[model samples]
Target: MPNITDEQLARPFELKHGEQLLMSSPKLETIGSTINHWVHHRGQLTVYMRLNDIAVPSIYGPSADDRNFS
Candidate 1:
């Protein structure tokens, strides 16, 4: 992560991403988007763990692996 001040979060910036695409958004918007993307992936990971009979830590609520996380 880079050093970002709260004042800068209100300002827009461009990110040169893969495939030569440029993403433009306010810092706060980008941060929220990044977090949402990770959360989506994490949900998939939990499903994968369940399929493999691996214990999954509680994220939002209790799972079959443990009922103490609600």
Candidate 2:
């Protein structure tokens, strides 16, 4: 794995699958809330997440918050 730096952890990102770039945010909590709200209203749907300022690994698939999973 490549070394991720603090600078990299401070940048906003978008989760991408092929050509599609999903929601971009610097805060994971905000992203989670947005996704939860969407699901509550629109039913369950798969959404992508991009990490900003941190290296989030693949969970189930991949996520910016995967590194924090305990």
Candidate 3:
């Protein structure tokens, strides 16, 4: 999977306030995997998931998982 650039991740989507995004390499399998993981761990937290791909900037609280971009 290719690394998603900061610009790509920073691009805004049509997401609501508490929406969760599963990060993937724009591939079906990868996207599916991310979704599956998110479903399984939905009860854990309310942040978006950057699965099998790149990291997105945190808009709310700090994310130790990825560097803050915004």
> For residues 1-64, could you state the per-residue lDDT of candidate 1 as single tens digits?
8997889998986787666748789989988999999999999999999899899987877776
**How much does candidate 1 score in TM-score?**
0.67
Instruction: Look at candidate 3 and give me any clashing residue pairs.
Output: none
Error of 1 at 20 (Å): 6.1
Which number leads on TM-score?
Answer: 1
Q: Cα deviation in Å at residue 32, candidate 3?
A: 0.3
lDDT of 3 by residue, 1-70 (tens): 9987756655544433566654425344555666889766763343444553445444355655555534
Clash count for each candidate, listed in order shown: 0, 4, 0
- After superposition, the stretches of candidate 3 with alpha carbons farther than 4 Å from their true spots are 1-26, 43-70
- Comparing 2 and 3 on lDDT, the stronger one: 2
lDDT of 2 by residue, 1-70 (tens): 9986766655776767889887666655455677889756542222322323444356356454665555
